[model samples]
Target: MNQRRQKKLSHHLFEAILTGDARSTKALLHRGASPERRNGDGTTPLYLASVQGEAEIARLLMEAGASPDIESSGPGSDGTPLCAAACWGHTETVRQLLAHGADPNLREDQGTGRTPLEWADGGPHPDTAEVLRAAGAQPSPHRAVGAM
Candidate 1:
């Protein structure tokens, strides 16, 4: 496929994942869609799925060999799939990512100097802090959660 067509398909797949349309994601995957194709924000389908708390989509992507630990590249480097899931309080997605070897303590120094845990703490998800702590995330003084 041409790059433009692939990019369009990737964007469509991302929208499917975000909308929690598991069937659409699966259909796209079966059509040879890439799980790791990143968007303008450097977020892949897995990352968008995690951020939107789409567990089923995330699972399908992971089954297709999506890397949960794929760090943001180029302009955006502060979030991973694990970070997105944790920040959004997607417990099942986070668990799946961790089981697939997503780094809990993955920190990006994209001027924010914030770890995944710090970003999670800043989000409204209550259990994210606990999850981060359980995953060996160190406390950042800037984060309001104050070390679990």
Candidate 2:
């Protein structure tokens, strides 16, 4: 497919994921919408799904070969899919990403920021923090949530 058409489909796929419409995401994937595509804001499809706590859509994206650790590329991007899910207390999404091989300790902010464990620990999700710990994530001395 052409790049333009692919971009359009990816946009729609992102919308579907954000809206929690698994049927639409699956249809778009069948229509060649790429799970690996980045949004105009430079966030990966899986990142959007993770931030929204859309575990089903996240699973679909992973099945379509979306990388669990693909960081957002746009200016002010939020880092990896793991970061988004952990910071937001999306427990199931975090679990899905980790099961799919997302690095438990990936960080943004040029590596000075919190790891996924820190994000989870600093947020309302102590449960998420435990999950990261079980996956071998080291604790951050900073606990910097940063209003994210």
lDDT (0 to 1) per candidate: 0.76, 0.86
Local accuracy of candidate 1 as per-residue lDDT tens digits, 1-148: 8888788888889888868999999999888788888888776788778878888888899898898877656354346778778777888888778777777777654435556677677786668768767877777656555543
Error of 2 at 42 (Å): 1.0
Candidate 2 lDDT by residue in tens digits, 5-102: 99899989978987999999999999999998888778788888998999999999999989998777766556888888898999999999999999
What TM-score, over all chains together, does every model reach? 0.77, 0.89
Candidate 1 error regions (>4 Å): 1-5, 73-78, 109-112, 140-148
Worst 10 residues of 1 by lDDT: 70-79
Q: Where is the poorest 10-residue window by lDDT in model 2? A: 139-148
